[model samples]
Target: MGRTNGGGGGSSPSSDSSRKFMEFAERNARLAGRLADLKVGSAELFLQTTEQTRMALCISDPNKPDCPIVYCNQAFVELTGYQRDDIVGQNCRFLQGRGTKPEAVSKLRQAVETEEYTVVDILNYRKDGTAFWNAVHVGPIYHEDGSIAYFFGSQWDITELLAARETIVENERIATELRHRTDNLFAVLAAIVRLSAKDTDDAAELSEKIERRIEALAGAHRMSLTGEGLAEDKSNLRTLVESVLRPYRNSHADRLEIEGGAFDLSRKNITPLGLTLHELATNALKYGALSTVDGKVRVDWKETEQFVEIHWIENLGSASERLDTHPPTQGSGSGSRLINGVVRGTGGSISTDYRPDGLQATIRLPIKNKVSF
Candidate 1:
């Protein structure tokens, strides 16, 4: 809605506020001549109409040395907390102070230099030095000779609007994070159940195995979520491998061996890789070397120019025969596909070799230069 004002031009008092505007064509003969070239009409009641407008308006002379303000309406004076005498002949940049953005200033400069229109949201200070967000629109008015005559500027205080928008964006981000965490929780649980079911036929045994796997997965998930791998205490390759094999090393200290240089893994990849390692260890405990008292498994990894190669060799130097070899079962194939899918999804590959000595597996994944966690 717009404000009403008494006027001398018409008896109706221009009640149609939407039609009220600054009549640039009738102010000066030079301006009137310029507006004629643009096919714009004259406004006899310019001051009366523009005085009631809420929007701030100013006109500057581009032909001047510094593009100083020549005319400013009542709204512009009220908005800046400045009187007509203090602001006239001064550059509009006097409103800019400490917190103004340099990039936004650069954009405004480019627009004005090229005599093109531009809109920018910038921080400006009132005469009292109080800060406010101003959405400013500026454009050039051309003379009949195709030369730039004056630069017109309009402004609106949008501090509250911007604050509201930021609040909504933050709320949406929090909601999205909550949804992702809940989904990950369910996914990790389902994976544990699927992999544990393959290792046992008895219900009790499956339950016990799932409980242990869940404990390991929970620890890894907790660490991954703590600071998204950016903090100083972020989990790395060493911690990830240890978390997966912690449950398997209860009584046999010498059964598992890990050798790898530490590096950061994104939170997104931690769970998938952790589950893959858990699956491999579970398979060894069921039918491979881990089934025997003297069995041993050595896990080693090294980084290359473009990839990281990880090797899992069971009973590497032992004389134990490959036990309970029933050509790849349905359960084993499912586990293989799950592990393969995880590796492939991360732009990697996995291969399993069943030799007489033991099961040798190799996983190769590309080394991403940077990871977002």
Candidate 2:
């Protein structure tokens, strides 16, 4: 009975140890299974997030030749209009086309070589050959050992944004041009008012003279805008001169003559040239040759490869005596200043000679290269 009791006690301790060991083993196994399930769940969640995200996402394996695409999300496929089977193992550079800028491509290439994060605005083409502006971001995915494992890229379509920005820039440029034109018109009107006041003391006469000058200016402006009395996209020298002199011609058709070959003028030069001709004609009607019936005025022009030269000659006839009595002034008068300002502003030259027999004027303007306005 003593031996049986000792053996039973020893067996009891052994049984207790085996039971405890079995309990520990079971707890460890359960923990390992839970850990495995958590890992799988995390991977599935990551894939779901990437696939459902609005921004296109792609991954390329660095270990592969050419760093070809190994994984791409649904959004990426939709953005590029490519199926997974078609794009897999293909280099992302397949998206580039002829319209893609070299500078942008260079930047992306440099970033990839260095495994650095970079963002670029690139022109990319879809599988169907449609183009879109893409704002692309690329960065390296590193392993725990600090080695590059893959390159991850994200893309967003930015075509509309770029177009909007361009539209805003064009609007600003047009506004600036309109403002400049308005200021120039106001200045010219103010100068006319000041200059016209010097010639007449009678308020009615001054008002009439000012009105006539403004009308002439308006006529020139209309021709410039409508391209009337001019060529399709240019101004004809003879046509413009005759149009400006038409009002004076009605009364003295026999007294005025114009002689010029066909010559084209830039649109920018039309306004200034018209203003100068109008001023000259007005001065002749009031104080120069055209004040008398017998007086005659001749206008002519010649064009060269580099310049267009114009000549104005007045035969004073019986009015020749007035030059001795009145003695034509130099460029001291307001009328002369007006003529000078408009002519010189266009990189042209003008000169006037008050001879004993008549008044003579010459103008030379540079010929600029043709351009679309």
Candidate 3:
């Protein structure tokens, strides 16, 4: 969580020639003489209210072996609980605690050594040795000869910001769990609709279909607990296809046929496509050509240069006239409609071909990582 920003100690007016500036310079010279080590300050600025803001301001000597603290504002003193006298000449490491990140410290060391501005988050310790999170902004200063001058650093307490972020993450987790529950509910509704068709259906067949669908719905919900993490696990493409076809593997029935050369596909795309595959298989057995043994079914898929195309071609030998000479339109049947919905939802394209040979449903999906394309 390291981060960086701008601080304003780079320069001063190099061309000041006016009488007022000259008089101010003269006063500054006298002040420097009286206090050689004291920092120069602007009277107007010191009187201003800008110093009391939420930001902490400090200056450091980076070239020093310990990077000693040179100056700190009143706000910095209050935020850190270290008065100017107590902090001056002390190594900035006094602000660091056990929880401070070593990587962040390395980044700061590099930025200061290189005399460049860098932003990072580091855990810091207060005078009481209590730890706090700080957004530290650091930059280097240079002399006229381009030699190291000193390091100027500022810090912002961001413990509250980090806490708020944690809260948001927790809320998001709850929302995701709720969404999965809702999706399963929809799956149940879809399963019942598929079983209740326009034609007369036997109770035994209905029960079997319902049971299969319930298991499929269970599969959808089970992916998280049993399946790999949403974005982490590697997926076997062939194994994925097999998993989707599991519900249609009825021994006594001849409803569907699945054939393909399954390679390992990326998990990101396969899971959604898998669910859509199940919905399609369910629909075919209920209302499509899979309803009768004379109704032959073929599902074949092959990979192309940029995508994978799965062809679900259903043929009705003598019942073509009864159903139609063409493939039924999506949404006309609960199963086709379900397939269409899942296909489109997963960034895939689907089209039904009307032919006397059979009703062909082709779904084309990307096989690469560029989903936006």
Candidate 4:
């Protein structure tokens, strides 16, 4: 026996789906190319297509008073939370508020007056008084008579895009700071180790010396990173030298003497000068004035209009009791190369003469800018 269903039958759902697909295909064939290629061939369908798009689009009459908006898409209404009737006759400037930049507004005004194409990003407000960044593009539409009939304008709410850009910039800044910190870490470690290894053969003695030099470098590194203490004031030219030599002073305090007038150094010059000065004191401790009780070291500087000269001299005994009679052809080890780098890096020249009395080194650097006297 056959059984019958209770509901009455209607057209199959597949038939309805087919009809809708055919309708879409027919409409799509009418607008087969890009909008620019079609050129508003079907004005009503073109306007309807723009209304369906997500981007806010509008049309304004150039011939009308105040160039009022004559048409606006559904997306524009949705984005601004404004009714279609309320927006059709108003100027787009209604979206602007106190937060809008006057420069951007002026540019928009000029573009409209000149009937030229322009794109600008401006701060705008919604109907609910909420702010957003809007990127707007506007261009003139010409009629068959070669006269401007309407202005076509499109806009995008770019608030999220601007926020994303700001986040990327902030991340880049943080990455750069981290890179500098890493570089400073390795530089401090390498400098102290190289300087300490030069003076001794005994492992224990070398270790002790390395530890002390590392401590000094750590102090300088802290100052450099935190911009504290002497490092905060770049105007003090002799601060780096004083810090490097402070540990080498004896109980009598006559072993080191500094005689330089107050002057400022640039930030780029500070680290190089600090490292170079540290290396110099290390050398003095090994063989020069600081090695002997009676020996004394004098560091003096003089400034001219175009140059600054620094003199490092070790006064060791009288001329009759001098240790070395002739200057060495070259300085020893990587210390010499490091000092050379510092001199060359700063666009300066250096010379060393091992006189019968003591070792004399002179560095002449061009005056970049003298912050103080």
lDDT (0 to 1) per candidate: 0.70, 0.75, 0.63, 0.67
For 54-129, candidate 2 gives per-residue lDDT tens digits of: 9999888766667778888998899999999988888788899999998988888777666567899999999999
lDDT, candidate 3, 1-373, per-residue tens = 1112223333232332233345555776787676555454655444354466557877776555466787777778987998889988776777887788899889887766445568998899889887788888987554543444567788898889999998888778757745754674575466445634432377776676556546665564445334455433345565666667755665414646768875545543554456556666655565567665677677788888876888878776666754542222454654456546555655677887756655677878777644411
Better of 1 and 3 by TM-score: 1
CA-RMSD of model 3: 10.3
How do the residues 148-239 of candidate 4 rate in per-residue lDDT, one tens digit apiece? 56778888999999999998987786676557546755765675577547756788987876675466556555544544433333435677
CA deviation > 4 Å runs, candidate 1: 1-23, 26-61, 66-107, 113-116, 122-134, 140-167, 170-200, 229-235, 248-257, 284-309, 320-338, 341-348, 355-358, 364-373
Question: What residue runs in model 4 are displaced by over 4 Å at the alpha carbon?
Answer: 1-117, 121-134, 141-146, 150-167, 173-199, 228-269, 284-330, 341-350, 353-373
Best by TM-score: 2
Can you write out model 1's per-residue Cα lDDT over 208-270, one digit (the tens) per residue?
767766765676667676654323323577778887888787755788998888876645566
Question: Each model's TM-score, in the order given?
Answer: 0.58, 0.64, 0.46, 0.49
Measured over all alpha carbons after superposition, the RMSD of each candidate to the real structure, in angstroms, is 10.5, 17.6, 10.3, 15.5
